[model samples]
Target: MVVFRSGLFFLAFLVIGGAWGQTMATVDRQALAELESLAAQHPSSKALVLAAQGHPVALVQGRATVGFIGLLNADTTPTAWRTWAQAHEAVFPGACRHGVASFRVDANHLDVLEALPMDRLELASRAVPNLDKARYGTRVDSVHAGLDLPTAFHGEGVLVGVLDWGFDYTHPMFYDTALTASRIRGVWDQYRTAGEAPDGFDYGAASLEPWEIQLMGSDTSNVYGYSTHGTHVAGIAAGGGAGVGLTGMAPASDLLLATLMVDEAAALDAFAWMQDVAEADNKRLVINNSWGLPQWGTPDGTSLSNVFIDGLSEDGVVFVSSNGNNGDSNFHIEQTFTTAGDTARSKVQFYPLSAHPHAWGQNLTLWGEPGEAFSANFMVTVGASTEVNQSPWFNTADGPFMLEAVHVAMEDTFVYDVVAEAAHPDNGRPFLQLRIHKGNTGLGVALQMTADQGTVHAWNHTHLSNDVGNWGQDFQAATSGWLQGTPAYGIQQPACGESVIAIGAYASEYLNSQGTEVGGSPAYFSSHGPTLDGRLKPNVSAPGVNVESSLSSFRDGAYAVTEEVEFDGMTYEFAKLSGTSMSSPAVAGIVALMLEANQNLSPSDVRDILEVTARQDQATGALPAEGEVEWGHGKVNAHQAVLAALNWVSWVGHPTLPDNPTGEDLMAQPNPAQERVLVSGNLSAQSTYRLVDTRGRVWQEGPASPVFRIDLQGMPPGVYVVMAWDPELQTSHTTRVVKTQ
Candidate 1:
């Protein structure tokens, strides 16, 4: 069930954003014509949404929502910025120094604001949801045994951040049983408007104190109760499994929590909140994000979320995200417009992933070449046209009849948005269909959507079949990995960030009968990738299928549980769930162990160690293809990864540097050193030097150095300052060096 922050229904708007240099005002017709041509090639019997490029034009104006803008560097004063936006009738809701801000305006006014000559500003529609769309022990024991790890390495001092839906903080899994104290440090709920927001953040429903959570127990009604996705995810990452025997990968790690709204602006805010908490607590942090934007394919890693991830990565924050479960779903399609009149079209069949299969909606965001104009149509198809299921719009022998249709011409050059939300007239099952007509075709336009929502498949228009294409087995377009071709593109946005460690799922079914063996193959549903930019992902894989973890009070009986136990007079249950969501937290838990081993490991270092220590897989006892697309480096070996982190040296440093002094100073050779950096220059026994990160945390120091080799193997990837002093010259030399690898 897709849940939105209350009171945000009126703040929804379409966001059309491109890189910093793209001209938003320019519209290309040839691109549009090409998309149309691709659409024309598809058959007519199946449902399809024509793909287009351009600013989203309203299909049927229903509601006016809020829009967002990221100022170039946030250089504008609050007063001046508000004045300019107010002139356009845009209401400023919140602003972050990170160059992000939220504003409310009608669709028409938003258009006016978009046309304004605002340099360095990025715009996005605060689109609302269409209502669509691990741990532990038994399987993890194999990983521990494989790596020969010590029992003391239980993620003791590390903090794990969960940027997901609301969590059940009161669960015994998140408390210190001996003292009955909460292990959750803090919570920033963007949906609760009743309390204060976290420091430096102005929005969110409420903030939770650890003590308040301990008092609430199972009274987690402040969060969405429709399902316990967040709760389950958190449990897999760090739950203690108190009364229950189910233990997570890092049961001893403390937690920092935040409940996010579906909006990107809110997500950015939540990221900042968690980072602030981590910094304040002075804890080595690794954050897990299992949620993603559904039905939106942004393989280009230039979205605002990517920007945030990049910025945070410099601060030595580790982020792990799910690769999504669309591996087998037809929610994504990419095809080149080879001929001038050729078209690419598909059937957007909807099948519910929620428990309430009949209630759901899906959103689609299409992108085509610049200056392309494509005609788009959404055709709704229903079951057989009997008395119980009849629709005047569709007419098919097997009962695949159309109920309603909507069409539009996309002239914008960047992104075109469409939503399929109407329920089937007969059975009331949710369905989303599309048909596109491009005037010309020479370039490729890709279509992407959420996988679990339903099926969307491409077919030859002349040979169109009556099949709805919604079956799980046949659903296979929106795969998350890079398409096998030149200029590889296909990492899902947000998760595509360089600093983000995207995780895939390892199935229990793939394991040996003993349940202690590693699987050579990842779960069929785990999204795979060499990102659109050719960056390999997911960095690693972990046990995800049928893993049992803590259950939420609100959803106690919604799903079956494996065990129930009492803690502090309250009953807590352990339930089994699957998906990359489970795999990601398992990795997050392992990261916590890594952090505990070496607090200096940078995000890049964490990713590298995991990949280096990952165990090569031979699915079905067959050697993996040299360039495997799905399994990434390999299945994660918790013991090996942790051991590598324990023995590995840090080579990453922060970005930026202070002014360097010139003349006969101690010079560091190989500025961006990978393993070792040598210190050179005239020096005596009394000469001394020190190397430290941007935060001024010194890592190395040596006395009497005419020449010194500084081991950068222990540093994280980033910029660091080196200070040296010579008693003879009586001058301290400060130089900046970068660490890579």
Candidate 2:
């Protein structure tokens, strides 16, 4: 009886085990070892570890102080996490569900989670870049048959958003002809800590009204000398030429401003709020980003920053970003090692004469293909002695190789972290990221890296020896031992996203004292690209060289170019500045014009239209080739784009329709119908009209008219194919109608 009972108990245990299934979670041994090492070294430094799935912790590992920003990916809230963490004295500064949340948990309490699991831990990382005038509006207006045409579109009813540094909202260039009202709808200064933040965001101050913006000039603290940068960019996009001599491409468009933050995460929050506000107001929005972070990993459009941009673009929000200004540097390389024992190496020297001295605190990064069976190491040489930091042979995991003062001969002058792993696992390639912190080394240092197998691509953001002056070049020895003639793939983040439109600078004309056209060419500083993941960027080029636009009223003396005229009774300033920054806004303003033409267009539609209608450079007489690095798709032609949009309405119809088209062309006075559309041209007495969608379903049908009014007041905002048939003429007409709120 006892034996039988024991056998029955064993059978029951197996049955219960099958029902329960496997419940063990995966643990990151590498991260744990790195954290333990960090605790052993810096006992007081605040360290934030990430926890993905709830993993189990054994004990307080070491004396090193550590904190955790538990990324609750499973199912939890910031409040709930805070409550649990607070039980052990954890602090919660903020939380973001749209992207990721940041929190802090003490190191002693960190060991309490013996069963916590996590995927990745982002410790932290830390763009002013310098574009164009005239030609944008000229091309756009001319493409539509000149500005004199009866149907002139100046971006009315659309919102042009500028995410930049300083802005002069009181400038007359942002005001109407009477100067009584400002085109600027709002301004959010993220640097200011004393005022109300934008809705849904905890940081930054807000100026909702134009009067409130003008009042900012007196605040003293908010008015900085840097205002000229943002002011000039805004003017190029939507200035009314009140006090400024040059007019923007979309003078009638509304302006929205957001003073930028240093971190991309903050940028994500700002974009989210701006987009939410625009959607609530039912306004078509276009954002111009003139800044970029070069230190960020891979221009493959897969970073968290690009992900946020993708999210925003899905909602019809357009982003125009600068490709960057690092065209002529040996900052990038790609090498392939076929021999089993062969190794690829590079020497990155941080010249002592750099404008940004102190390379000890900067990041030095490299990325490689995953599962390519590669090994990497870097030897840091300062003067006579050499210290090497290399990865373990054939290690599959990425790392955070921190170089402390005691660990190496160099003390206090600099510290850095060398890491190698897959930045985007979904992309099927691994990457190596190296960041040197507290880099105070006054003496120049050299970095030499080697990979065992496969292709190893490298980039050095900290070393800019060849970039001695503005628009400088180092063609002869820039690449040295690395591959040459592939300066492409240097595009900045966010713009690398598939949806964003990346703009580069092209010299519209070189002017003499009398503004004579001497010559023209692509700007040397315009960054080139076929992004890291191999995507052709800088969707198009625009005039950005020595372009004059509005300047800040707050900028005094040397800030203003005496050679350039200041208009608006000298109340506003105008200055000539150049960079991809100028070109970005120029393209954005042109996009605003496109949006004004067709509000139902998506991000892809806009990119395709711009590429198809772009004008070939007059100097080269060539358009951008399939994968041309610089001068992407040639210079922008605004008029052609708008005309293409108008033609697209006849061919592919609007984005509102799915795939099927059962409607014929019917002439409407206004293509983008706001309240009502008047059906007039090519109408028959006994003609009938039917309105359908891409789904092949008819919504409304009525008698065709020489003078007929289509009530679109109650219709949702989208594209509708209007088909009209005349029994007498035996003709059917189809047209696309874009409805707006």
True lDDT of residue 108, candidate 2: 40
What is the lDDT of every predicted structure here?
0.52, 0.59
Q: What lDDT score goes with residue 544 in model 2?
A: 80
Give lDDT tens digits, candidate 1, residues 505-605: 76653335676555335666776566644577777677677767777766634777788878767787777777777888888988898888788888888
Per-model TM-score versus the true fold = 0.61, 0.69
Measured by TM-score, how close is model 1 to the native structure? 0.61
Candidate topping TM-score: 2
**Location of the lowest summed lDDT over 10 successive residues in candidate 2:** 11-20
True lDDT of residue 129, candidate 1: 14
Error of 2 at 190 (Å): 1.4
Give candidate 2's error at residue 236 in angstroms. Answer: 1.3
Cα lDDT tens digits for candidate 2, 452-549: 66666666655321111112222112234533423556787766788899988877654468966654577877888878767888888887877778
Worst 10 residues of 1 by lDDT: 460-469
